[model samples]
Target chain A: MTVLAVAEHRRGDLRPVSYEVVTAGREAADATGGDLHLAVIGGDVESFAEDLNREGVDAIHTVAVGEEFDHGVYAQALTQLWADVEPSLLLAPNTVNGLDYAPAVAERLDIPLVTDAVGVDAGEELVVTRELYGSKVETTLAVDADRAAVTVRPSEWAAAEGHGDATIEPFDADIDESALGARVTGFQEVGGGDVDIGEADVLVSVGRGIEEEDNLDIIQALADALDATVSASRPIVDNGWLPKDRQVGQSGKVVTPDVYIAIGISGAVQHVAGMKGADTIVAINNDPNAPIFDIADYGIVDDLFDVVPALTAEFQ
Target chain B: MKVLVTVKEVAAVDDEFEIDGLAIDDRYLSYDLNEWDEYAIEAAVQISEAREDVEVVTVTVGGPDTEETIRQALAKGADRAVRVWDDAIASAGLLDPATKATVLSAVVEEEDPDLILTGVQAADDGFGATGVTLASAIGWEWAAVVNSLDLDTEAGVASVHRELEGGVEETTEVDLPAVLTIQTGINDPRYASLRGIRQAQSKELAVQSLSDLGLDAGALDSPMEQTSLYEPETEGEATVYEGSAEETAGELAALLREKGVGEA
Candidate 1:
């Protein structure tokens, strides 16, 4: 038995979670006394698979195929792969692509499905843990099924590198074209320049308290000083103050970083779902009663204009 | 063109949530219209106010609880309301929301709307797959995350201004009978009018169920699978380093360097 870690990619660039997933898969494989298998499925995934290879007892499986994630195709191929490999545990990132086909795979195999997991441990029965209810609580679940598939949240595990010249192998399956009923005729890739949120080390997020579009300069100045990315609550994006790429919420990009400094924002549940995975959550909001303060590891109550400038000057 | 927009009744975007073993405590949740769906409705109303033939209607999928969301839409001036309740689909063992979207798309196809709109993403799943999935289910031309729209019934085209990264906006002109996933910032969703608030109760709401869509809840394919729930590892402590500007700047740079930036 082995633990399979599924990697995510957009237009072929590997998602940072590939490292984190391997870190997670290694843990599961270690406890169950099995190997770790890293699977990359998409077009042009060879270079990505090699980068994610680990020496933790097993091989890397690359499902390089003509199919670019047709749900039925992925589901059927994964189901067959899991059956052939008979892994003790399977792990995937809790991502759009992962969520797309993971359930179908679980449903086909009759395995317990656990998602948005923060931690996992080995035991007589595998214990998968996830944050529940908007970062307010931690639920550690002892999955009731013998065979289990899980999607691990990104950034939770710092992928620990071990020594190995790990071997790479390509996975070829006889994909039934009929199963791939829906084909992606074209894809709109979110263009790049600064790092994607998943890979950012630090993020300075502004909430509704940012007040006006003019106030963003001080926030950007602060981000510039800190070399951090600028992000915001839905209100800012919805107000056309910023692009949708900057929106961080349940309806936006879920990000995990080393440091997340929230400024002038009330923590709404929607916003919390996205950034709850951050390592150090520092909230800067005037309202003590603001929902943001509840999940903030550290809190600052003051005017954002004054506070943000002070922080910017300090960082500069 | 009476535009009928569909919204979903989901765990509120603001509700406090808790998970006790297998059960999620939904008490803190307030059922409201999906935020992005509200934009679609708001856009429809704006079009109706500008055009003579257009009137906005609100449609939703859920159990009886969905009726409240419909009422809110009515209170905001939707001319009519329809509720499709497939209690079986509403109550299924599968954890996929796409299953719901699949059922919804099949039902929506029968309504024959000149154009259909949804939010770019739903708050609950944040999967952002519903609108695209619905479009595929019906085989309609689809454009996602549109910040603006202009409906031209004459040439049979819907002009959409799409939001992209780097503050880029793409203007797309799709032929009529298309699906648009409304982006945020389309317009502020309007509040209910007092006259309309009172009239909401008087509005005739036609309620249907999954049976009406001719869907056997079991036949739908649930694509996404979940494995287990794990709490995120806590990000380490972030102690505020308060000091003079010079001291803090020096400290901040040292910290960044320690994290391996500017090391080379």
Candidate 2:
């Protein structure tokens, strides 16, 4: 058995989550006692492949296509590569690009696929755990198929580390031009005037507990005093209180800031999935049983309306 | 041009969800259109309103009560509604995302719509597999989790921006007859008007079964079987600080300083 991992890159550079994909593949490969092979597919991605010389990797396959991301090329390349390698298990990031093509690749090859897996175990069959019902429940399914493809969620698995002298091999996907039905034209930032919370070092986030749009002024003030960027849960964005780009959750951007201040947020599983990587989490909520408190490094079980103002004044 | 949008109705479980064996207790559960599908319906309606000779049809697969969800889509501006249900499929156990896609692709073939749209993922299953799988099963180009969409009917192409992780977006252009799985916050979904709801009452909601579409019952089989369903284990336990609002803030600020979080 062989485990093939798809490395993700953006703007000709490898994203941090790519290593997690390798980590997932390493686990699968170890379980099956198979060699682990990683593939880096993009324009000028040769250097990106060098960054993935992890201890468990057996080899790296580089496919240069002179484009950052093209759905048609990606699907075609994966399919063609699968035909060549015929790996028992395939792993990819559960990001936007991976989801766009992973399912299609599975359908094209007639293989079983599971997306957004947070837990993975291999034995007689591949067992994976995924969330359902708005992230309120967990369901574990066993994939009995011989061949399976999985998209591992970011931040769930530890990034693959340690150095290895894996053999580097250049492979040509040899994708047919006629098979390319879609082409990437350009890239656009969402809302032109949106905050990039994913890159923030310190974040002061709000949620439905902020009450109304007018209440945002206080939260903004606290963020300003702390010199931190302001982000929010889905309700703030849905109600137009905050920009969608500022929303942090499973459906939104994943952030791993140095410090995350969650104010009045109940810490729904959907929201927690994105920010679980924060170095330090501080939660302020009146409800003692709110799930957010469970994950918070420090918690204040009091009304945020009173606590937020005091915090702002203290910071000032 | 005809557009087919897939919609699903899901139970709204509040705090303290009761799980009876493998399924949640539906006694206290209320039903609503899957939160994500509302964005898909809104996108379809916006396109239909902008383009001439375009009709938006919403479809779902479930029991008879699921028609309420389809009617909601019709009231929101869909020209027609459809429900696909068979007693046999219902009794065969849960329909996996693949099976759901197969059933939906059959409907797409019957309708022969120029475009098919659905939410990025259903709120219940959150598999995020149906739309893309349907596109593959039907041999159509597709883009998932698209935040922005624009179609040039004359040129037979659709341009969309897919929302990626880390706040980055990639734009792509797909040939006509494509499937787009819409993301939330693309646009504010409109509320159904009173008159539109009245009109929807008289509108026809066609129901189709597997036999009607000439699909085999085996198509409903799921490749994977769910062995267990349970609540995830909670991670770190919290150390709650009890004090007045000002005292709590003071303690929190000191802790942050020790942890090297906020500016000191």
Candidate 3:
């Protein structure tokens, strides 16, 4: 069985999640004793091929569509490439571009697709583990198809690493211009001036338990004292206490910081999905039964008003 | 303009689930419309209210218990609802995503909707594949995680902005008769009013089974079977910090220093 991993890129640059896709593909390949092939589909992705030379990759196929992340072009290209390679398993990042084209590719290829894969194993039978109910429960599935297409969730698998001597091959796929009807016109940043919590090394994330808009000053002060960035759950943003950019959850930006101080956050499944990847999590909530404590590295059951000022002074 | 909005009912996030024989224990679990689909319903209603000659319809695959959920959408302003269920499918076992998409696409073919809307993913399954796959099965242009949408009925085109990771929103123009999976925070889903609830009792809710749609029971046979369902393992149990607010704060700061957070 040949396993193909699709590399995710933005414009000409490759995204970090591409390596995770490779890791997922490598795992499937190792389990099935199959060869692993990685593909990068974008204009000027040759350099990306060199960057993607991970140790377990058997070969790297670079398809130069000579365009930005065009959905139609990607679907057509993958379909053509799948026909050429006949891969038993196809893996792609469960991202904006990947989800856009993966379904169409699966349809065009007539392959069963299992998406948002958190855990997958190719044993006697193919099985995958996925989260449901906002990450509250896990469901395991056994795919009956011999050949399957899957989208691996971001931050679930560790990014692929180490160097390899895999040969880079340029793949030419037949492009159908008429099918490329939808066009990506532009990209805009929501709440442009807000801090990007995704890039923060340490985050002080507030939640609904923070009470009201005026209390945000205390959280901001704590962030300043710790020299960390400020983010929040959906309620904070929905309440207009913080900009949407500062929100972290399933609907918001996913962040993987070194230290995540979840102050007054109740740790809802959607909120936890975004920050669960943090190296160290410290949740401070008055509610001892808060689900955030399930995954928090450290827990503090206390009122934010009393804790925030004390923590701010201590950090200072 | 005819619109088809898809909705799903899922266990609440805080609900603890346990295996009751073959299925999860539902006695203590409360169900509501999936969070993302609420936004889809709201988007459908807003769009319908904005344009003249627009009607919003909803569809879901569920047993008889799903009628109340369907009625919730009707109260929220959907013109009609279709419940896709058949005794043959229920007896055959759980339906995989491909089968669900096939069933939904059959409904789409019957409705021939100018627009199809579904949540980015159901909170229950979290596969997030049905909308895109349904679009593929029916041969329609589609976009996922759409936060902003504008439909130009006259030109048969829809302009949408998709929310991507890292705070980026991509604007794209898709032709009408397309599918859009709405993201959360697109709009606030309204609570059903007393009048709307009373009026929903008389609204058109057409329940169609697999055979009714000319789809065979074999089509609903799921290739994927659930081997297990359980609470996911946690990496490590949380270590609680004890003291007064100030003392605990001091301890936390010292721990952060030891961990080398913030260049300590």
Candidate 4:
């Protein structure tokens, strides 16, 4: 059993998840007693391969194709590489770009595909653990196949450390430019507004629990009372109750405030990814089982409607 | 021009629910249109509204119970709906992305739409791979996690903004006859009006079986099998305050003040 993990890069720098995927791949390789191979495609492959040659990596394959990620190129390159390496298990980060091409590669290769895996056991059969229904429940899936592809969620495994001596090779993939249909044009930065939630000292974040746009007045009042900037989960911003700059999540701003009070937020994984670095985290929600409590340092399992007014009065 | 939107009926679990076997109890689960698909439908309808002779058809892979949800797409703006379901599909333990792409590819063959749109991932399964997999299965171009789309039918290209991590977006140009997985907040999905609801009742909502789409039970066969399902053990070590709202608020406020939160 051989494990091949693919590294991801955007712009000139490799994403952090690339290192985490190495750790995941190493673990899977250890379980199967197989060599762990890492591949970095596109953008400065030489430097990326050297950086990805972390502990437990046996070999590094670099494919210099494009500067940035293009799914068509990725699908073609990975599919061709799959035929060359013939690894039993292929691992990639469950990032946006990974999802863009990993599935197509899996389809072309005709293998079982699993995404967003938090846990992987590659003993007799590959078993993957993932969340469902907004992380309310977790489920484990078994891949009953000889070959499989799995995308590991970011931050689940620590980034691999220490250096290793690995054999590096450049694989020349036949990428037909005429066959590619999608082309990367440019990149843009969004969520630009007056408020920079990332620099706030205190944040009063809200979520769908606020119920209606009119009810956002209470949240604003609470933010005012605490003299803190108002931030929100995706739903509030999606509903137009708050601007995109004030949104906190994976796709939004990652904020590490001094004191972060989560009101009515259930702390979905994406939301927690942004605010989990806060110095002090507090959650106020009606549901005790809400994932917000899992990461909160202090929690009040009560109605946000009743608690917000009282908390506001306390600061006032 | 025809735009095909992939719609799904997702089951949202209640705040407190019981796991009956490999799924949440039916009584605790409420079915509704997938959040991301709402934006997909809205994007397709917006295109249809702006262009002439644009037929927006929604395709769903669900049972009869999902027609009500499919009708919601019709009520919003879709011209018609196609639902593919059969006993073999129901019996299939888990329809992984590959299996789903195989099933949907058949529908794509029959419909031959100029453009196909789907949610980035279903709310229930959250695989987030079906659209791109379907694109590869059918040998079409694809863009995933697309938050903005600028369609130029004459140019045969769709300029899209794929939302990346940390507020960065990558703009790309995809050739026509592509599959785009729509992300939320791309558009404001409209509420179905009374007149629209009345109209949707009479609109064509055709149900197709595996045979109807030139597929067989083999299309539903998947290499992935769900072994177990359960609620994850809560890893919370938070010091939960037990009291009235005022008391808890006082405790939290004191902690915040001690942390120098409101001093500024």
Candidate 5:
């Protein structure tokens, strides 16, 4: 009876989403009265186990094949591993790759699966909380199972700090040549110039409020003056004005920046899905009724074009 | 070259959308062609459009109600559409993604398409499994989140543009008859033209049953049950900006700096 938290990574670096899963897994294991086990499935990702171990987990399971990024390879390997571990609660970060494999694992095992769970509680039945209606609702779910699985939403739980001896155990599986399904051949990271939303301490995010697509220079200038990273609501990403990587929302990345300055954003639920975790949220929008105001720790109900230049000069 | 594009229909995203227990209000939920599936349709449409020899066929498992989605795919330029009719599919014990992949792989075997396309994830379920699962069952090559694609029909090669973190685009060329799940930013979906819509009305969309694909209706046991559904909770307050750009910038910089945002 173990709780498995699958660690997500890129290259060799552990993604912040994985930490979120750790928090969620810790919660699940506590509820289920099971040991929490961290699982890493990337090539040369052994080092990540040590870092994940620092979060005070019991053990780190490594399937450190170079083919970690391959979806089918991952799904089949995890399925075989689950057979060996038989975790009472299986956890993964609700990410693109995680989504790809978790359901397949559920189907292969014929187990109950809950995805994108924002909260978890144990009892006679394992209760999970999920955000519905694009973060407008939090739905409580009670699963009928002794063993269940889920993908944890990012930023829902705090990543535990401090260290424990997270022992690493290597799991070997029969990964046939055909099982890989797709070879990455190679990979290219998007927007090499900007810091990721998950890593940024401070963020000056733009929404539709910046007006014209060309008007983004002001937000860019603000990011520069602040030495802050730039993130955006979904529209900016969908419109191609900003890279998809820059967009923050349910579909995009969820970030927990130190201070989030939302420029001209109306704070739609989809938009807030990305920035809700910021420590201090400052919203600058013309419309007072905009939902962005609902979450702002401090707000300025003024036209953005008027406000941006003053701030740029002030920061300068 | 035959290419299969799998798409689905789901509840529209709304700030007001909440699951009232087991039921959802489809009225307030505006349905469009599924957003992630749009990428799949675009991939197929582009392949067939650029390469004269490539044939794109779209598939989905739904009832008479989902015909609208299949027609929209035709407007986007898929040559034909297949609809597998099964209300049981929703509750039939088979995982929605795996079952769909099983059915899809079976269909593809008959059509023998070189390429298969599906959205990276379904907007409604967000399960994101059909493409890879189908590829695995069929034992074919696959790529995911491919933002750009250029097809070489003659050489049976596909050059794909992949999006990565940090704003980098990776382009790779692979042999034909592979599967690719499209990233959201691949290309803007083409609106169904009146002509295309009219043509779609007459196009042949073969509807099959779960058994037709050799899948038992009750192959899966749902491990989770929907105990309750409710609206998601909104956190915090909205901030409205006022005043001139200069004045606001001044106030904004002060606020930002206080938050450790501004360097100067």
Candidate 6:
């Protein structure tokens, strides 16, 4: 058995999830008693190969196709690589770009593909553990196939580090330019506004628990009382209650505030990805079983409508 | 021109719920149209409203119980609805993305729609792969996590802005006759009006089974099996404060002061 893990990059730099993918692939490879092979497509493959040469990696394959990701090019190149490598398991990141191409590769190869796996084990069978119903519950799926593909959830595994002596090889993927149906035009930076939540020392982040847009006044009042910056989860920004600059999540700004007070936030995984690095975390929600409490250092299980005003008074 | 939107009826568990065997108890679950699919439906409806001779049809893989949810899409301005269900589908256990793409591709074959839209991921299972998988199965173009779409049917191109991680958007152009997985915030989803609800009651809703779509029960066959379901153990060692709102707030305030918060 062999495990092939693909590295992800955007613009000019490799995303941090690429190292995490190597870690996940090494674990699967260890379980199956096989060697781990890494592949980096497009955008500075020579440098990416050198950087991806982690300790557990047995070999590195570089496919120099284009400067950036084109799903059509990826689908064709990965299929050709799959035919050559014939690995038992294929691992890819569960990023936006990964979702863009992994499905097509798996579908073209006629293999079972599981996305957003938090846990992967390859013993007698492949078992993948993932969250359902928005992280309210976890379920384990057993794949009854000899070969399968899995897209690993980011930040679940620690990054692979240290140097290795893996052999580097270049594979010629003759990508058909005419077969490409989609073309990348350009990239733009969104979320530029009056505030940069990333620099705040203290943040008062709100979520769907705020109920209505008009109710954001209480959150604002609380933030004002504590002299903290106002941030929000995806819903508030999606509702246009706050500008995109104030949103904190995977697609938003990653903030590492000193004191993070989560008011009415249930702490979904995507939202957690941004603020989990805060020094001290507090959660105020009515539901005790909310996942927010699982990471909070101090939690008050009460309605935000009652607690916000009361907590605001304490600071004032 | 025609647009096909994939809608799913997702089950959301209550704050406190019980897990019965490998699934949550029905008593503690409530069904609603997936959040992401709502955006997809709105995108399709907007396209229909903007052009001439355009029809927006919704396809769902659920039983009769989902008709009410499907009607919500019709009420939101979809022209019609298609529900694909069968006993084989019900007993298939886990309807993986591949199985779903297989089933939905058959409908694409029959409908021959020029554009297909689906949510980036279903709120329930969150597979986030069916739209792309279906596109590959049918050999059509696709884009994922699209937050903005500018479709020109005359030019056969759909310009989109894909929401990448860390506040970056990638602009891309996908050829028409493509499947784009819509992300939230693409557009404001409108609430169904009372008049629209009444019209939706009389709208056409056609149900098809595997055989009806020229597929057998084998189409539901999948290699994935859900073995267990359980709530993850809480890992936090937080010192939860117990008391009234005033009491808890007082405790938190003292701690915040100790941590040097709220000092001018």
lDDT of 1 by residue, A56-175 (tens): 637777787753545555666677788777886778877655655665566456565667777787667777665543454455656555677888876678774665556677767668
lDDT of 5 by residue, B1-264 (tens): 788888787666554444554657665576667787887887678767775677788888777888887888887788888888776765553244555666777788677877787887666656555675666567666665677787776777778865643344555665667878887777877888989888888888898877877666654344455566665444555443456666555666666666656554
In angstroms, how far off is B40's CA in candidate 2? 0.8
Candidate 2 docking category? Answer: medium
lDDT of 3 by residue, A1-316 (tens): 7898999887567889999998899899999799899888886778899999988999998988865788888888888788888889999998877888888888778788888888989777789888765565678888888888989888789998999787899998888888776788988877755467889999999998888889899998988888899999988886566779888886688899999999988787668878999999999998775779898999888887998899888767
Give candidate 1's TM-score. Answer: 0.63
For each candidate, the DockQ is 0.15, 0.60, 0.56, 0.86, 0.38, 0.89
TM-score of the candidate numbered 2? 0.90
After superposition on all C-alphas, the RMSD of every candidate to the true structure, in Å, is: 7.8, 3.2, 3.6, 0.9, 5.3, 0.8
Q: Which residue ranges in model 3 land beyond 4 Å of their true spot?
A: A194-203, A208-230, A238-241, A249-259, A264-280, A285-291, A301-316, B13-17, B242-264
Off by over 4 Å in 1: A66-90, A99-114, A120-128, A138-149, A163-167, A175-205, A210-231, A243-261, A266-282, A286-298, A302-316, B1-6, B10-29, B40-66, B74-204, B208-264
Candidate 1 — number of clashing residue pairs?
Answer: 25
- Please, what is the whole-model Cα lDDT of each candidate in the order they appear? 0.68, 0.85, 0.84, 0.92, 0.72, 0.94
Q: Spell out the clash pairs found in candidate 2.
A: none
TM-scores for every candidate against the unseen true structure: 0.63, 0.90, 0.88, 0.99, 0.78, 0.99
Candidate that scores best on lDDT = 6
Position A262, candidate 3: lDDT: 96
Local accuracy of candidate 6 as per-residue lDDT tens digits, B1-264? 999999999999999999999989999999999999999999999998888999999999999999999999999999999999989888888999999999999999999999999999999899999999999999999999999999977799999999999999999999978999999999999999999999999999999999999999988889999999999998988789999999999999999889888887
Query: Comparing candidate 2 with candidate 6, which one achieves the higher TM-score?
Result: 6
Task: Please state the error at residue B257 of candidate 1 in Å.
Answer: 20
Write model 3 residue lDDT over B1-264, tens digit each, in one string. Answer: 889999887766443446665466767577877878888999999998988888899998887887898889999899889888878866876566677888998898899889999998876677777888888888888998898999887887889999887667889999878999998777878999998898899998888988899988788766678878777675549988898998888888888888776564
Ranking by TM-score: 6, 4, 2, 3, 5, 1
Chain A TM-scores of each predicted structure, in the order given, are 0.72, 0.84, 0.82, 0.99, 0.75, 0.99
DockQ, structure candidate 2: 0.60
List of clashing residue pairs for candidate 4: none
lDDT of 2 at A121: 86
Q: Which is the leading candidate under DockQ?
A: 6
* Cα lDDT tens digits for candidate 4, A86-117: 89999999999999999988988899899999
